[model samples]
Target chain A: MNQEEIIAVQQYENALSRVDQSVDKITVLMSSAQSLAQQGTQIMNCFAQLKREQQAYEAQFKELKLKLQSDLIKFQNIVKGAEARLDRHLDYIDKWTNLLLTRDLGTMDSQELQYQRNIMDAIQMANDNFNKELDKLYSL
Target chain B: MGKNKQVQKSSLTDEDLYTMLSDNLVELNEIELFFNGFLQEANVIDESFGTVTNIFNGLSMGVLASMNKSDNEKINRAKAKIALGTFVVGQVAKGVGSFYSYVKTLDRANDILVLKKEKAATWLDSLHRNYDRVLRSEISSRKILTHLASLGYQIDELISNREVYDVKKNLMQMALEQYRKARFNVFSMEFFIAECKAWLKNKHDSNMQQPILQDVNNSIIQEVLFQGDDYEEVIAEFFLGSNEISGSILFVLNDEQLLSHYLSTRKDPLIISDGVENKHINKRVLAIFKDNPALEMSNEFYEIRKEIDEDGEKSRKIFWRLIVTGSLLSTLVSFFNLYLFCRLVMAIDDNTAILSVLAIAALLAFGGLYAKFEEIYKELKNKISKNRENYERYYRYEFALKGGFANRRKKVEEVVGKSFFDRVGKAISSLFDVGDSDDHSFYYEKLIEREYWNPFFVTVSIMLILAIILTKLNLFFVGSLVVLLFAYLKMRMRKKYFYILTFIVVLCVVFLFLYMKGVI
Candidate 1:
């Protein structure tokens, strides 16, 4: 080849080499882009997992709160019932004591003994009820 | 020699020229594909960043809701830790995304730099100048023509029209335009990376010693979840050096108005109101002054602030003492009443006289206690109202000062219109009528001023009258039971329902009265 034709051939080779280098760089960039897309997908999955965990935790917490509130109400009701029973027992005892103070007993009489037995039975029943309530509260 | 060079240039055949131009065009197309790939990566990073922010917002809301909803300290701490962990994880994800973006941007920038240099070697004037037109016109036309050719259309005439379209020139233009766009994208990416770095730096600096994360956790636990006595100070300290105050912070603090005021006016001088002596609002004001040095504070205002703080401390002590004393007395009274009620019930079946005496005593005691309680409540209410009035006055004064002389004048006019002398005159006139000096006339005027025709007052008066009539008819126990039922309904039911019940009871009472009088 002549000098001008040789020069033209050399320039073409140089342009081809640059294009080769550009393709290599482009290939690397495309891979990096693919990796980023993968990373994005992973992040989305993680976000969904986190949301699910939060929802589960909230629902569990709400259930626990409701259980505790119901237990508290149950305990309160038991205490109130126990208190009313004790008051009734106290009133019965007061009446029995008043009867004893007023009635003079020289000997054991069936009528006074019956009245006393009835008062004692009522007091025993109240005691039994209070114990049952106490057992219920402790179980809770 | 020039003629020999021209002949040598023509020595290359048309086929060789077309092959070289087509090869260059293919390379340009590949580079354009890479640019598009880089752009898609950026979009991915953008979407991930958005998701991270969304996660952060969700975590913050969770922390706030958990703190507010739960009173259990352990649960609150656990929730706070979880929230902090999730936030840290989100931040990590964001950091990774940023790193990837930074790397890709640098890579793209380097590619564009090479293309810029290549412009000198090629026929293009400059890559940055011609890239856009080349990409839009030449590359787009090539794709469209190829698409049409694939659909069975012959476009050889269009392709061979060299005068209308030069292939090499179009490739050069496309490459240059793509280079320009890539360089612009690099510029934008670099700016975005810089912003990300700055944000990270700010976060690091703010979270250095007393990290906002830990502070928020502590505040949520101490102030919101537990409501510790020093909550005001805890909240104040939390906001002292905070650069970013989120909505969750305000929500947990439970005093959005106060915190928002502190934030909005942190740069300005502090204003202390008279009633602020009871609350620890001045601590937050001082915190503001500490955070922003540019804020101006007058010595007089500072002294007033100090004096008010001292007064607040003293009043807080007294308030606590009052609460303790009041609560103890109330508990004692309640126990006494409960005991008396039990005794009365026990005595009911045994001794009628004792029962009657005990019931009367209990009734008198309850009435006396209620009257005393009402008096104390009214006194406390009056004191609170007076303090509120003073606070409102000071608030208006502060507002006026901020709003300039025109507002100050307007406020002054308003104050003058409601002056103390005018209030005293109105009170005196309410007590005594000027039109009539008779004592009965004064009583009539007083009744009118009291609005005796008010529905509530009318209801109460009619109920009382019905109770007295029932008692006169020898249904004293029934009268007492009816009164108790009505009182319970009044306390427990809504006003509308209570009014309806009251109307029914009144109608029944009226019928009973008519029947007793033989008029029904």
Candidate 2:
């Protein structure tokens, strides 16, 4: 080629190389963008999944809480029944004490007096056991 | 087997009989209610299944488009994976929805049973509270010896009341049954939800595992980058071509309305063949022209064009019918008049009478021809104006497409330009009628689809011809009137029909009254 043609050829080669470099750079940048977009989408989907799971968890928790409350009420009712029985026993003890105290222990036979005392003690023990059970139920 | 069949045939009192029947009925009703509710819930679940699958289908398609890379095999493999993933997701959702619905039904049944149990519990509590009082009140020396031989007298007081015990037992049994059913339903729901979550996670992980396009050096990536000048072109190319970067672009331009509108408006039948609903068209157009702010038309342009076409069509149809009917009637009248004139000249020898008859016939003929011509002129004027408006819309849309780049604009213009009106015009002109039919036929076609003319008008036209023939025969005046009545009724049942009917009735009543009064 002539000198002028040679200069043109050199310029064309330089331009071609620059264009090739630019293409490679663009490809890299575009690919990065694509990956970023994909990641962003995945992130969005993750958020959605998390939200749905959270909602389901909340529903389950509500059900569990209701169940716990129901069990508590049931335990309370059992405790109340035990307490009522204890109260009735206490009432019987008070009535018996009145009947025994009115008769005068001094005039009563020793054996009969001893028997009454033992009965009172047994009633007291039973009442204590009932109260203990009630307390356990309440704690539960 | 029924309870009655299982129960022994024992003699019972009226009260016991009533109680047993009611108890059995209530139990039967509960069972019936559960099955009915379950079946209804199943139907709702089935209905939602289609929707859930469709949602996943759309999602997978969207994901596929967004992850648009150049490799055909990779894209196809990704497509298959996405399809399978979506199917799994759909199945999971379907299962979950169905299980949840079943759970809800069981929960409802459980709720009713719980309420019954609570009622029974409250009653039992009341009984227990009064148990001591009842015992103290009822117990005599002899009663204590008979009942309270042990300290289980209080328990016997409740247990001895057979009715109360049976009712409470039934309530507890029902409640337990409901709880069991609900528990099973809940278990299934939990399983389905867990499976769904796992499938979702797996799908997500698999999606993440796909090799990211880190370099855009390939011809495919280059082609994608230079697909079109605008967002719409990018969207279209992703839908149409195998672009490796579709996923990225779709995610970036994540307007569901716009995407749907684009897909629907695409001319390729294989693409979204069903055009988006009318409501979405303007939004789609605006989205496509978002970058081109200088575009003259607003969204209102579509509404305005529709309104103009509708209003213009109504009047044009009226004008066309009037012109056609008037011309036909006028021509017939003129020919009849000319024939009469010729007959008078040939037969009648009285010069004055013939001249007068000729003069009258000429005047009548002239008047009819003038009216026909006037109507024709009016019809032409209306069609020309309507056609001009429709044609201008095409050009305005075309100009809007000429934005930053020629190729992109050309594509957009081609899309928006070849819209509903243009397509109808082209279809009609090519297939059916061309020359003088252009202006009227385009509007008429649109109008006809909205208005049922073929059945009503054709019937009326046929009846009118029959009526005219019957009248010509002079055989039945009442028959012709009946035919006319039938034709009138064939018109749409709108306010106008009522008004016309009322008008005719009033006219008939007036005529009848006047005749009765000897005033006419």
Candidate 3:
């Protein structure tokens, strides 16, 4: 082939090579974009799942709080029951002291005196039980 | 004469050919001009790539969902890309950093050659970008070789286009040869351009990012369960995109040998990030920063500072442990001496004077405890002074980073777009002027508060003992000690105002006199 024909062929080859390179770069870029988009969508789903888990945790916390509140109320009821028992013991003491001071043997017969003594013993036992409960409350 | 007189005849084809040649030459010139601009922009891109990588690495892992089947790949890719970008940009930024670092130390860079040297560095970097772009491209090797071949021999010989390109070896040789020629201190514009082109061509071939096919096809997927690394804030923002991700970063171990980072989605997080083992924070930051010496040094400074801090803590603990031991010993000795004094009193011997000596020893022990607190305060003040002293060093590195050294240099130029530190200095000066409440004393106040509890209790215990001794000494001594103890209490009322002045005046006079005279 003549030199002119060779030169013509070489120029054509150079242009063809550049086109190939550009097309290759563009193709890679396009595919990368598509893959990236797909990945982004997947990430969104993961975030959605986390949001659900967070909501579940909040619900669990609320339930836990209620359980603790009920336990606290049970302690309060024990204290209230102890207070009522103490009030009855005080009432008996006040009434019996007045009877003893008045020297009313007729009003307080043997059976009545026995009944007052029994009530005093019961009050003493209740006071000891309340003290034990108080110890437990303080420890808690 | 008859041949010369004959006019040279031209075909229409010859005219067309001439026009095309003229057009091609003009196009070539335009291409060169366009290339210069693109190369500069690529430098900016290279810098951006680095900074973006740091941002991604620093991306909080809170953003990335817990590693599940989905969203893991996306996060992983982002992480890997950032790491890789930092590595490459680190390489580019170092050239600029070194030049600036050199500039600072060149107290006598007044010569024309020195300024010219900077110009040469600029030119080299400008061309380096072109080389990097070429390295990362997919242009045919033949095209490059063909252009290079034209630079060497006759046009006809190079244009023949029958040659197979031996690009790898040829590039290395060409670059080395240009460098050798450049050793003559030839700073000519043409020579500089040639050298840059040679460096670029040597570094990257016409074809870029080839698949890097290996003979051993070992592309097997192994599930890496990265536990204990946990989800970090930096990676929280990273999430999986599909089940597959791919990228790379550079990692180094033992302060040398930059490694090619390989990322894959099949593995767990830090499945790959665990490149550096047992990194101090500074070293870890440095690892991210790579060849940026300013950043490396900056990180290194912090590491050293932390080590110093740990050492200081260990020392303080040892000091306190000794004090507690001493306090207990003094208490025991005081009891033993008091027992001996009681026995001597019953016997009515002159040996009872030993109690006075024991009393003096107890007072000295109290003085020792007081000194320990003072030492702690003094050390704290020293810390303030030293850190303040270090302000210059930190600022220099800051300035170096903020100046025109590394990634920050380009960022400041882009974001702030002017002399950045000028405004920073102004703000700092204004802060100092406005904050006249003396923040320095705030730290001292905290020290006093911490020291107050121990020293106060010790003083009270000592004064009570002193009062007992005084009572035994016919009441006069007891009254004197009572007076002294009350005055000490009154002094503590204005403790913050008196920390420095009171310590210097009262402590020196009181502690030294008491210590030297054996009444402390």
Query: Which candidate ranks first by DockQ, i.e. highest?
Result: 2
Error of 2 at B38 (Å): 88
Off by over 4 Å in 1: A1-140, B1-240, B243-352, B375-379, B407-520
Could you arrange the candidates by DockQ from highest to lowest?
2, 1, 3
Best by TM-score: 3
Ranking by TM-score: 3, 2, 1
Cα lDDT tens digits for candidate 3, B343-430: 6654423343445444544554444444444455467546644643354344333323222122110111121112347434433433
Alpha-carbon lDDT, every model = 0.39, 0.39, 0.34
- Estimate, for each residue in B14-122, the C-alpha lDDT of model 1 and write its tens digit: 2332233222321233333344455555446545665865566465455656566666565556556656765666666565555544444444434433432332233
DockQ of each candidate relative to the true complex: 0.01, 0.02, 0.00
User: C-alpha displacement of B115 in model 2, angstroms?
Assistant: 98
Residue B445 displacement (Å), model 2: 27
Q: Report fnat for all candidates as fractions from 0 to 1.
A: 0.01, 0.00, 0.00
Q: Is the docking of candidate 2 incorrect, acceptable, medium or high quality?
A: incorrect
Which runs of model 2 end up more than 4 angstroms from their true locations? A1-140, B1-274, B278-298, B348-402, B405-520
| True-structure RMSD for candidate 3 | 46.0
Query: Candidate 3 chain B, which ten residues in sequence have the lowest lDDT sum?
Result: B213-222
